[model samples]
Target: MTTTIEILNPTFARVSGQELRKAPFPRLEEGTKVRIGFLNNQKPNTQELLALVESGLREHYQVESRTFFKGDAAHPAPPEVIEELSRFADVAVLATAD
Candidate 1:
């Protein structure tokens, strides 16, 4: 009598995927009437940073801006917040600081 052992083979299959692409963001134009959104994640110094940016944009560009503060910096801004910003503002500026 003879005993036989089965051999198992392992293989890696490629996942269904496409090539990664660069992020798509709208360009801010000068001398154009636009609305900008400033997002504060509630982190320390983030509000101050955004405030500076807000004033600078106002001074340099012909644009309008609105600020939205996220309750917690640890968590991402919710979809509703993003949707509202998209609807209300032409572009968003997210700021974080240590």
Candidate 2:
């Protein structure tokens, strides 16, 4: 009696050259408005940090920020709160004080 063994080769899909190229940075012009969102994670001194950030933004750029949304001490911000923040601001900053 005789025995035989078989081997299989692995196959891979090829990627396009365009897909491997890095994306260009977005162009920014002067006087463009910027929106900033601040979230208070119910930590101590949260207000102070927010104040500092607000002042810095005002001095540096055309910026606007909404009041800190207070989250529960034991729980994170609800979906509604997150949705509200996303709608109101372009970017958000969540803070916690030690």
TM-score of each: 0.69, 0.61
RMSD of each: 6.7, 8.9
Deviation of model 2 at 71, angstroms = 2.7
Any idea what lDDT model 2 has? 0.71
lDDT of 1 by residue, 1-98 (tens): 89998766467567679888976676766666778898889877787888788788877578788888776887878888888887888778864745
Give each model's whole-structure lDDT.
Answer: 0.78, 0.71
Which is the leading candidate under lDDT? 1
Model 2 compared with the native: what TM-score? Answer: 0.61
